[model samples]
Target chain A: MKIIVCIKQVPDPEHAKMDAKSGTVVREGVELMINPFDLYAVEEGLRLKEKMRGEVVAISMGPPQAEEALREVIGMGVDQCILLTSRDFAGADTWATSYTLAKACQKIGDYDVIICGKQAIDGDTAQVGPGIAAQLGIPQITFVRKIDEISEKNIKAERLVEGGYEVISSPLPILITVVKEINEPRLPTLKGRLNAKKAEIAHWGPEEIAADKDKIGINGSPTKVDEIFTPDLSKDGKIFNIEQLDAAAEEIVKKQKEMGLI
Target chain B: MGIKVIKEKCTGCGICFKVCQYGAITMAEKVHTLENGKEVKRLAVIDLGKCTLCSECVKPCPTSAIELKAEAHKFEGKENYKDVMVFAEQRRDEFEEAAFELVGKGRELADKLGVNLYALILGKDLKGKGEKLISYGADKVIAISDDSLFNFLPEPYTNILIRIIKKYKPSIFLAPSTTQGRALLSRAAGKIYTGLTADCTGLDVDSSGNLLQTRPAFGGSIKARILTPNMRPQMATVRPKVFKPLDRDPNRKGEIIEEKVPADLLKSTTKFEKWIEDTTSAISIEDADIIISGGRGLGCSDNFKILFELAEILGGAVGASRPTVDEGWIPYSHQVGQTGKTVGPKMYIAVGISGAIQHLEGMRSSDFIIAINKDPDAPIFKVADVGIVGDLFEVVPLLKEKLKRAING
Candidate 1:
């Protein structure tokens, strides 16, 4: 079994700041790291690889700098790394990006499963994984929390719903977008880092993948961002400090009663 | 972008023609001569000039023959579209509260736009349940009933929705930003080639008729207003609990249009295995009217019992901060933060929580907030309507006892 894990390099959301005047995220000074959720996907792929005795290939599509993200995943135990990058791939929405990645998957044939993070922190759309599955014409199970069982032909997994979860089973050649609850990602070892430093990273572009020129980037995206502006947040509320716990409890009860909550 | 049809794979399903809101694709009879001298039929051809490149016809193509080709083209606005439509999400044969909330909001927007408010309900044997939407301010209810729709599958749901949007051409489409809604609406929007704003905190229609979608961005540091002025049937997924449902009116009468699900569109790649209903006593923090949450300050997993007890007495749900969940003190499902669930309870009690920005992002919209922490300088106090500067171990037990006695009385 060959497990393909899709990862992305995102500006550390903690340090990500919004430009109040422009209403756009200012990511220049922020550090870039593997999207926190993708780490779990990579870790799950490695674990599946260890059990299935197959190779784990980590793939990413972003700027040239994103190769470092793929390398880091390789350092964490992936066998290979592939970076899909090109000037033409810039500014693509989830649809176009998934189309390009799906085309890449088709080029990298004979994969049993493809794993992706549930959503990217910056975009938070959570649409790319399912979009890729749609483009590949394969079954998709999103928000997967656990892989209960897996075989060469079929796999069963637990998917997170609103309040609980559902067990879904799909045939082989399926795509699953996983949440952080799946597994704890492991840190890179010294030997793994050494291998990662020397490993060759493959790069693919639209031409290499035989992708349609019109469907690989911004042009292929159906929706366009018309404008972005900051929302007004002007509300005032009073905060009271309480010294006595018993009195505060009685006061809260009275307040609830006054508010008709009781 | 231009829509392309792969001739060899086209099945002439006519789904594309039916789903194309722009009338770009038209069925033309063409005879194809095979090498064996047999005549065959051809599929609908897309006129690039009229194609808005929304790709609405791509997903329902049974043969997967239609592809949206990337090209430098701008989508033209459609003037014929009218009314506001809300996707009334249902789970386990019942409507989610968010569904009613969307309808309520949709009604307001529709009135502002001077159009009818419509609700689209899809499920198995929906029967008379759709009439409930009318009381919630839906001027018309379009119900699509099919056994396959009982459990939400993205493909079939998107296909049916695309069919409806193409046929009705609603100007605005709203859905709950819950798990199922996010999944279904995103795919449906992508298929219909429309812009979708997810997890919207506020939605309003501008005087110019553009939907103003405001959502938290940059880890909830800022709210960004998004506009998809170029697309028809502008789409947005509103967060649950952001709006209150309209009061039910038993006397309210509305039109109900029942549509049959196409048999061919029912074939889905994914299969339903089993729905493991949440049997745990745990309540969805999002739906909880009152929430009592703890953070790393609780020190130990055992300390959660007191918080749970307080929540139980208050008829509330217990939530945890990111650190507590990361420490394995509680499940991630109970986490409240930017990466976890966003909740807006009527009253939120933050015990021992330092109020990280991410944590505050989830619950800042709560009606009223109370904070209890040992450190008076904890940021949680800033957002709290009431602050108790003390040890939680001492204060929590006292409050719990008081609440238990008050409830018993």
Candidate 2:
């Protein structure tokens, strides 16, 4: 079985700064990491590859430096790494992003399973993984915390829901978005790190993937953010407190009654 | 514009039919011949002119077949509504502080926009609380008495709200971004097909009455400013603790418009399984004076034991990074980040967390944060009020013992 793991390099938001004047993210002097969630996808792919004895390819779409993210995955024992880097892919929302990623997946044809993080940390819409599944015309599950079984013909998984869990089975070549509950990713050993240093990353672009230009960037995205501004901190925040737990709780309940909050 | 249902995809689940308030959809049969020359049964539907396009049908579809295609930028009309009203939420026979806080914030925008401030209170025998809402500066109180509304359910509440909103035509509607508020408002707004900004951190009014709603976007990396340009009752949901509640005065008085929940609308299609009491009352990381959190860098579950020890020393609750929860070292309920709880304690100590964007989204609002890690360049330090660049294995135990000594002394 062939497995493809899709990852993206995003600004380490902790160090990331937004340009006040332009209202855009400033990437300068900021560190980049494989999207934290995507690391789990890569690790899951590597784990499946080891059990099933197949090639694992790490695919990412970003600027040229995104190769670093894919190579780091290679260091974790992935068989190969693929970079879908291009200037044309900037400012893409979830819809356009899934389109480009599906194109890349198609270009790296004949995959049994595709894995992605439930959502990128940057977007948090949690839409892209399912979007890709929709675009590819495949069954998809989101918030998958555990993979119960994987075989040549089918994959059984447990999905996390608000109150309980859903154990569902799907046909092979399905796309899955994994939450942090999937599996703990292993660190690169000394030998694995050495292998990653010599491994060559394959770069693919819009031309290589033959992606539809219209559906590949901001142009393909239907949702546009009209305006962005800071919320004013003007609420009346009076801290109502007194001594005694029962009294405090009672006072709070009284206030709630007064406000019709109960 | 009218919404068209894809008949082939409709599962005859009656979800859309039951959810529709305007009685727009009805079951009809369409004949079709298969490749084997067989006739099949399929559900048919109709689009109603009064359909609000509130995307409620899209979620309950078991097959995930319903598609909601929205036309962009429908907000294009003169301002007709007046005042900003918040459905001040109540929990367990008490008013939530977040409600008055919304009223206080709405009061400022209402004054600026030259409109009255209205608070909608729905509860059983909660007239006393209705009086306090006006004292918090609500110019008008729309109190509806109903025993069913004692605990929140979608049916009569949404129907009543829709009726009141249509009658008054308030310019803006605000709801607390709590679980109940989010559930009701989302369905109600989606039913109306109006734009709503969720988890808003800030709100304001322009000279022309457009509600300027600010919320964290791009996964809390940046703040996104949103506006409902064409929609009436421009809606937003603000998170609790993000805003301050107001001071009340007994002398303040406002007219109370007592309304009744329409009996017909009380027949709800959804059922409530159980009322999950606010677990925060028992214990909450946000209310803790001091908080200790563990991140992935802790290396193992054995390491997290130190975190529990530290939290015990501080008399605080132990929190975990998103990764630690995934590692099964902790439960997801204790996870702290954008997807988890937003906490602001006096002291927040992050142990071994690298501080990803999602992680920061939840806790960036904390007052004083201290980050400890082995890596000097860990991103946790960026937001940490005090950065201790060292091995958490060595640093956590040492700090826990020291804190224990100080507390004992």
Best prediction by lDDT: 1
Q: A1-262 in candidate 2: lDDT tens per residue?
A: 8998889776565565433344233443446678878888998998888888889888887767677887788889888888876656654555567778888888888888899886666545455665566556555655677887889978877654333345656777778778776778889888888988899888887899898776665444433444443323122222211112233234323433453423
Which pairs, if any, clash in model 1?
A214-B70, A215-B70, B54-B193
True contacts kept of each: 0.35, 0.09
Task: Report the Cα lDDT for residue B384, model 1.
Answer: 69
Q: DockQ: which candidate is best? A: 1
Per-residue lDDT tens digits of candidate 2, residues B1-409? 2246654566667656654423445666667544566565665364543333334455556665555443444344436677789988876457877788888888888889888999998877775877788888898889887666675654466777788888888889999876556545644564454555667777887777788887775445456666666567787788666666678888987888887766886644333333333232134564455668999888887777787777765666778887887678876657777545555555677888987756766676665566777776665666665666666676666555545554455
Write down the TM-score of model 2's second chain.
Answer: 0.71
DockQ of each: 0.19, 0.05
For each candidate, the alpha-carbon lDDT, in order, equals 0.79, 0.67
